[model samples]
Target: MRYLVHYVEDVTERVHAEAERARLVAALAAERGQLRAALLQAMTPMALLVGPEHRLELVNDAYKRVSGGRDVTGLTYREAFPELEGQPFFDIQDRVYATGEPWAATAVPVRYDRLGAGLEDAYFDLRYEPVRDAEGRVFALLSYGVDVTEQTRAHLAAERERQRLAAVLEHLPVGVTFAEAPAGRHSVSNPAAVAIWGVVPASPEVAAYSRDFVGFRPGPGAPGSPEEAARRIASHEWPLARALAQGEVVQDELVEIERPDGARRLVSLSAAPVRDADGRVDGALVTSVDVTERERLLAESEAARARVTAVLESIGDAFYAVDAEFRFTYVNRRAEALWQRCREDLIGRHYWSEFPAAVGSESYRMHHQVMSERRPVHYETISPLTDLWIDVSIYPEAGGGLACYFRDITARKTAEAAREAAVARAEGARAEAEQANRGKSEFLAVMSHELRTPLNAIGGYAELIELGIHGPVTEAQRTALARIQQSQRHLLGLIAGVLDYSRVEAGAVTYRLADVPVGEAVAEAEALVAPQLRAKGLGYAWSGAPPELHMRADREKLQQILLNLLGNAVKFTRPRDGVPGRIEVACTVDEERVHLHVRDTGVGIAPEQLERIFEPFVQADQRLTRAQEGVGLGLAISRDLARGMGGDLTAASVPGVGSTFSLTLPRA
Candidate 1:
């Protein structure tokens, strides 16, 4: 009973206070659970890392999705994302935790080792906030992240495109320049622009453009002065400046520029104003191409054309030109006189219309042919209007046209006609002479045949009486018979010569042609003439020819020619002053022909009479009482026979010297 009196004085109050503290603790735990649930279900990616090792203490569903649905709640940050070891995210998280400072980054790049997706690259807008305990000492890190991969990639792609366009614009061959709107301040220029201007202006304003780029409008004649030229193409007149001020496009405006180096250049400029989305002028772009060489060539071409025109006007002949359409393009002074019309009436007019009478003429046909075939032609025609002969030449030009030249040839044509008339008169006289000669040959041929019949009858009667066919004969009667018979033989020989001459003139004799050996033919002729040579006391010599040497001639005709030649040589040669005359026969051969030469040291013929001796019924000595026995037809007959056998007889002689008779024939 005494021990039970312990201090129970306020124990109930202490128990009540303890119960209130327990309720407060339970409420706080419930609220913390609700907060955790809220964090895990959030749409944003969130994670909690605790301690120095950065163990992943909590991760939301959005965070798990970003990690390729990987369960990494109990893993350290390094273990969950091993691929991000070298990334700035790992170091940044450590720094945030160590400094107990909140850190944030936009478009930060990260690499992750996802569960089934392997390694992946992602961009994010991330924030790291430090979690502190009651003492304000950092204990854990809270990571808040937003996936900005698509947005960051789009922005990067736009930046790369801008850089590529800038590279292309820098390397263009044609000069390019850009200037800001309104003020026309130079903002961008390629290397080609600087090269064209020769120098870059120190100032970027439009007013300074002409300081380095002095220019003038292209036109004839020279610019007055440098200052005047600059004023002519001031900043306001420049194509680029005009485009910026007026919002207009200017194309292919030619400008002659004077560089700072004193070199002049011609440029073709094209400019247009750059527009903003609201269709307002924003800037101006310009392109320039240098055309100095091209302009110089054009000037030279004009000068060459003028020179050609002067040459055409100064030529002697009548000249005209026609285009491909056959319309007259030019008519010279001479051409105008020849056409009997002024150049104004002929030029630019159709050729046929100007000269209608020339249609269907040879000149017209040839002109058409020259144009169609692109060839040159020359022809003669008589003008229908003037009736004068003209020699016309038409030449095709390279530039689809024709050039024509004309010369008057009426005097030449008249001379040719007169010469043709004289030739006709001479031909008629020759024809009449040939007919008279043919009649003479026919008369001699008839008389020769008729006279031989009576001469043969007389020879038969004389021979019969001498043989005592009719009665007995004495020595006187026999002597009388011999004289008559000798007279008959002489008359018959004359008739035979006449007959041969007649036959040759009428072409009635036929030759028996063969390859006759020249040596054998000469030997036979020499034997026949041996008696005559002996009688005249003349020396005769034969120059032998090769046995194989032959001539393509008639054998009988060749023998006759040699006999006549040798006989004449024997007859003419005689002893003079006790020196006997010599007759020599020689033969020579070439690759295609043979020559038989009979030379005589005798009474040689005069040069004027040599050719006459071979004419019909002609003689060197025309006296009636000539010493020669037979008619003077021997040489003539021989020459005709030689020619009939495809050979020729020619004689060369001097009055006091010897004579050479050469007979030429084809060799086999």
Candidate 2:
């Protein structure tokens, strides 16, 4: 040992060289320690995978924390993250190890069963670097990752939202458009916008929007031509442009647009400024809806309303409309005239306030009832204000209102009142005339009764003188007595006829009605008139009535009527040119009546005097010198008797030919 250091030549240099080497080695180890410490404490998740199996060799605190603090050291990547077996991460790492090329991935999704918990998904930005031997062959992989789960999930969610909005905009029914601020240099439109515009135009600047969009403003003083429309819709005037320039929100601005195909459309455009986070207008959002049909329908409805108003104004009847609160909404000209107030004054005025007197009248009651029941009512009432009768009709409106139609009937009411008064006066005059006629009939009845006794006494005295009961009489005296008796009988007959007429006129006569054979009554009349007919040399014939053909009349009255008719026929008829005058009786039966016709070949009555012959004391021979029989009272009495017993007597006559008297009686 003593001999080893004896020949040490410049050993100090050798010792110094060894010391420097050690120092260098210690510094390198320290630096490596600091690097390892920094890597472990760093917020970034970092791990080292070694060998082809990609076994986890070293893991920092951040990496362990990211792995849920699982002990993944010395474990293969596949074993550490079993859920990642089928994931691209495992294969990506293998490729990075085999290729020895540095690899990086952003938002690489991984599944890890952290701390024996269920596998949870995490997003990461991953980096894989190959660790090579000195021979330059890939041996191990170094994997470092940042747990970018929250950032990556947020980015993915935003991307999904953008895609969803894109899809929605594509299919939206309402047209939507977006334009960038600062003159709208950039613009985009949805499919609906393209459809609404009829063609998708190139994106245009804000200044060119008016020229490119081809729209017109509507209403009064609107553009009359295409050039005018273009000029009117200036760039700054457009809804979208206004929103972008002035930060204005324009809603439901109706614009008429002419499409490229020459078809026009009405669009309801709404625009709002799209503000940035700083509350500065950066863009414009526009929505458009096609309202052409709606606008057209509204215009048609307005026209119809105008037409209805015109008709209401032109109608004669007063017309007015009232709301549910009884406030007047509209009034026509007639209504204004009837109310004696201007339409401007009546409109929007309460009905009861305008006509205070009618507040509790029938008109008010009916109006309330109609409104409540939604029914129509018609009534007539006197106007409280004008004191005129009015016909009112109230109809319920569909929208909780009422329509009223009224008319002034004052003129008609006045005329009706006047007519009723005239009718009353006429009725009084008729009553007075009937009373005078009854008085005259009473006077005639009393006078005729008073004359009948004197006439009968004169006739009895004349008969006694002719019989020579007081003294002897000559032939001349007997003839004179016979003449006096004849005159007395004729006078008595006239007085009896007058008395009968008076009784009939005074309604004092009575009748006993019974079914009498018409033929039997006619035969009895013929017997009574036979003697007179023989004296006049007139032929008479009777038509036998059927036994079953009976007349419902008083027997005595019927016989009297027949006798009078036959006697008149015999008296009026005279032989003309040696031809004997003839009288004929004919009987006929109808459904409910029997007619007895007495015909005579006598001078017929004048057409004008046909009716006058039936009057009392009137005859065909009206001259005082005429040779016809006594007064015409026979026919009048006969007609009165016939009518008293449910029968009528009528006559038809032809001048210079013949006369026929028909007696019509109810058949039994």
lDDT against the true structure, per candidate, is 0.83, 0.83
TM-score of 2: 0.48
TM-score of each: 0.52, 0.48
* Tens digits of per-residue lDDT for model 1, 1-668: 46665665768877898898788778868876886898898999998899878898999989998888888898998898787867777788888888888998899887775445677767889999898875899999988799988898899899999889878877888888776777655567778887886655344443565533323465333335767656746645656666876788989877777765678888887888999999989987878887787788889989998998898888878899999988999998888887788999878999988789988888788888989999999888897756889988999999888999988899999998999999999999999999988888899889999999999999999999989999999999999999999999989888889989988998999987789888999989988888888888888888899998999998888888888888888877777788989999998888898999999997889778987989877877667787867778888998888888777899998766678999999897
For model 2, give the 10-residue run with minimal summed lDDT. 214-223
Clashes of 2: 0
RMSD of each: 21.6, 27.1
Residues 1-668 of candidate 2 have per-residue lDDT tens digits of 35554554678988999999899889979986886787778788887788888888878888888787787888998888777777788878888887778999788777776445678878888898887765999877767888888898898899999999999998999988776775653267788987776645363333455344423455332336767656656644666567877898988877777766678888888887989999999888878888888888898999999999999999999999999999999999998887789999988999999889888889889999999999999988997877889999999999899999999999998999999999999999999999998988888888988998888899999888888898999999999988988898898888888888988878888998888887788888888888898898898887787787788998988888888888778878898888999999998887999999999999888999999888888988888788876877888888888888788899999988889999999998
Error of 1 at 457 (Å): 1.2
Question: Any runs in candidate 1 off by more than 4 Å, and if so which?
Answer: 1-332, 347-349, 372-379, 391-426, 472-480
